[model samples]
Target: MTCSEKMGSFYSGITCQDIPPHVMKKARLTLFDFLCVLRLGAKYTVINPIIKRYLVSLEHPEKYTVLGLKMKSSLEHAVLGMSVVSHGVELDDGHLSSATHPAVAVIPAALAMAEKCHSNLRDLLVSIVVGYDCMIRFAKAINPKHLSLGFHSTSTCGTLGAACAAGWLLGLDSEQLSHALGIAALQSAGLQEMLHENASIKPFQVGKSSSAGIIAAELAALGSKSPSKVFEGQYGWFNAMSNNDYRETDLWDRLGKHWMIMDTYVKLYPSCRYAHAAIDSALELYDEGYRMSNVKNVKLYLFQQGINEVGVFKVPSQYEDALFSVAYSIAIAFQYGKVRIEEIASNLQNTRILEFADNIDIISDKQMTDSFPREAGSRIIFEDDNGNIVVRENKRARADFDTPLTDEEYLLKAAQILENVVHRKYIDVLWEKVVLSDQKMDVKEIIELMNEMGA
Candidate 1:
């Protein structure tokens, strides 16, 4: 079968039992990471205003946790709320190969749907694995150059993943699932132009795509018919959007044998994934006790892919720009020795960060450029005042799944986020329930608990 055919079959036929144990464990970690990011995102200047505006306009009550907030909305509203929280901070998980924020797009839909259905924890876990699988598979089929051409994978591939997860949870047959995929394909949209304009529409793309996928699945379940060959038919997604043909067999090459979730990397810093390696390199120089002032110039050697994505910010005037700027991220890490979420939000425009950013230079290495997709690496060289030199090269950061955060560290991060958005006591309770419990809880009860905790 072609890649598209294999993916179609997997989404249409895979059952909960088909999920491997290692995949399930990774899914759980993803869940915890998603919640942590969501909680922290609730306070993001861009995300909070929109969520509050929507909540104020609501006339009826519904069930579903709105991350750190206490307000509950309908299932659809819940998906939107959670999605905004997930993507607002730009701290969600991203695929190293695809450069797509799969969890941000897929997790919100799964959580909203699972809450609406009151599905068991096992079922929820299974749905997340399936959702991630579909998202990564679709992303893998597309060319990275397509994104450079202004397409946003978070919305495009994310919609298909959301549809697959919703279809699975809704108990739709393979035919209905295919129909849902077709419906989802029609609604997918997000563009790289938002980054250029520094618009807040980026997160909206994630929420909109996610909610749209749920709507597609619901319509399919209600007997709505859509084109069967949404992926491979003439003038379909690949041909229309990318102008490239895909090998459909690549979609299910390993199926259950290899898990996509295991390849996902969590963020230690609340910046773009493209900026992480540079930040790591700069941090290493700091750990070696190099003074920022003594550094005459800093040169960053990055893969072409990283440069294309984050090298846009030659001079960043705002927080969003700084987040996407390799120069800014490296400068801040070298100056302060660390990059935290609060620092990104508040100090992106600080005079010191700007001055340091001015001294930083970024260049692409042809050798490193050749290793694209399979790995993300960076090399930093520092020139000191006395003609001294220091260098550090990191193949990958610690947050990569292969070198994941410890359980205590994960919980501590989660707790810190909760403390920022909700009451400490409530966060403690919710943490216990999410981490220790095996039974499913009502979506309504979950919302109520968050409300009591000052949602």
Candidate 2:
């Protein structure tokens, strides 16, 4: 069987009962995080303008609900608008091995379809899990190399993965699911060039991928036919985009045995995953009695993949670019002992962050290449003013840990996001729908809940 066949078979055979309890728990946790982020994302100073443009330009009647907004939008526009904001804030969940943000793209696409089809939350959970599995596996299989080839795996693989989830929710048969995958595969495109400097196109990649998934699935349901060899055929995703050979079967073999949804991690900082290890290590150094003043110079030894993505834009010339900078993240984390959204905004070009960030050098480490994509390891060498040197390594990145967030942590994240914009009632409704419930949810009601207090 080809990749799509194997995937379609799994989608057809898998049921909510077949998902393990732990995987279900992670799925819910992932959803909770996505909801919290979107609540804050819709109001971002940068993204809100883009939202208004679409709202004004399209101005269509309500078909699906856009989170944190009163106006309803058509399904594709709704998915596109919500996904752009969801990931625009840069606090969304990601699978480290494949380096894809599955939840941001997959969840929005799934929710839009659910609202349109009147599907329940139980089925929504199934679709999300299946999407994560397909996306992360494909990403992990080809990336680092896929990234070196200049393709953003998140958007490229994301289109296909979200299609799986969307197709499943729309009740596409095995053949139709494969057809949807083929349609999405052809639409896949996202470049790392957006990471260069303050480009607003970053979140649009996820938005387009999510919207493409729904559109592809809809087209497939309307009798679209495509090749089963879409993933590995001549001039297929692997042959055309990958810089190295990718074998998808082994990753697929571990699918049911290992849930990729569980492997995906949440970010404590709203920066690129490439810079996460350095942030974690810098925070630890501060805790170990090493202040920014105590440090003379800092050097980061990252894998080639990390260096390629984040090293070029070392010191962010603009606010949004800070999310993709190693120096900026390390400097901010070391300066304030934490990285926050407000700091990135208010202190985008703060002299302190710039001074520290300028002294930091990011060098590509060839030796560490083997541990990348799968492990996301990094080494930090610190030189203090007193001539005392500290070398620290973050091997088991904080983002990919096995434990889920506690109840307090979950609520705190939500409250932090909902701090200045919405009322307590907004959070109350959000918490109930995302954290406290497990029954079949009418997705439209979920949208209504967001607008309870006129969000």
Candidate 3:
């Protein structure tokens, strides 16, 4: 079978029971994380507001609730807005191998489509699993080369994932879903240049991917025809996007035996995933009683991809700048012994943090470069004026597939993330009514609760 047909059949065939219990549990955690991040992200001063304003200006038909906005919108508008909001804080769940943020790209579209179609909890969850698999597979086949080519995997590959999710929720047959996947492939567009030219475009691409995916699925449901060989065709996604530099990995080796969502990592800090190991190492130094006062200079060694993405030594002038800067993230870790949203927001202009960030140097290490997108390792060395030196290395970040966070840890992260943005009572109710429960949920009710309670 062709790549799109294989993926279309797989994405269209998954059911709630076919998904293992552990995979469903992971889906619940991802959904809960997405909701929390979406709520907190609405309060962001940058990208969310621009999206909200632009959507409101369009005045799309009101069909669904926009979380944290206290407004109603069409399914497309809601999906676009929620998807963008989820990534606003930079804490969305990401997969290492795929190099994409799956939740932001998948959940918003799936949930919005579920609500629109009145799909049960089973359909929603199953669609999520399928979406992650399709999106991650597309990315795993093309990235870090795709990323090296200045394409944002989350935005590009995510489009296909979102289409798979929406098509499954819409009950499209395998053939129809193939068309949806093809349409989504044609619509895929995101640039890593957004990281420098405008960070707002990062989340904007995510939102657009989700919205465009829904449109693709809807078009396919209307019996629209699409190119069949969207993946392996002569001038298709693999060739055009990856410049024929894609890997030939088995896209369906284990299939249901190995769900891609299981390999996804949850973020502990609200910065780029590349910066997480550096932050973790810095916190370890802080825990060892190494304060900034005693440290003279710091050097961080990271993989080439990490250095290319977040290892810049520039001082952050705003919140967006800080999110992608390993130097700034580490500075926050050492200065406060933690990297919290509050610390990031309050210290954007702090001279101490900026000065410390200036002293920090990020170097690309050959060993780490060779092991990247798998190990994501980082090494840090600290020196004192008197020649005292300390070194630490993190082979992999916490919350990785191997070192997954417990359910309690996930809940605690939710609380920590939402403490300032959402009311305490709402957080409690959400945890109990939505996340902790396994029963079928009224999708509309959950969306309503989010609309009323978020922000």
Candidate whose TM-score is highest: 3
TM-score of every candidate: 0.91, 0.93, 0.97
- Pairwise TM-score winner, candidates 1 and 3: 3
Local distance difference test, each candidate: 0.74, 0.79, 0.84
- Minimum summed lDDT over a 10-residue window in model 1 is located at 1-10
lDDT of 3 by residue, 252-313 (tens): 76887888999899999989999898899999988987777778778889999888778653
lDDT of 3 at 396: 89
Model 2 ranges off by over 4 Å: 68-70, 421-429, 453-455
Tens-digit lDDT string for candidate 1 (23-92): 7767766776787677677667375676657775986475656665556677666777778767877778
Can you give the lDDT of residue 149 in candidate 1?
66
For model 1, which pairs clash? 2-248, 2-249, 3-248, 3-249, 4-248, 69-455, 70-455
Q: Which stretch of 10 consecutive residues in model 2 shows the poorest summed lDDT?
A: 243-252
RMSD of 2: 2.2
Against the correct fold, how does model 1 do in TM-score? 0.91
lDDT of 2 by residue, 38-118 (tens): 766776636657675777588787778877555678888888877887887788888776778898789988888888888
Full candidate order by TM-score, most accurate first: 3, 2, 1
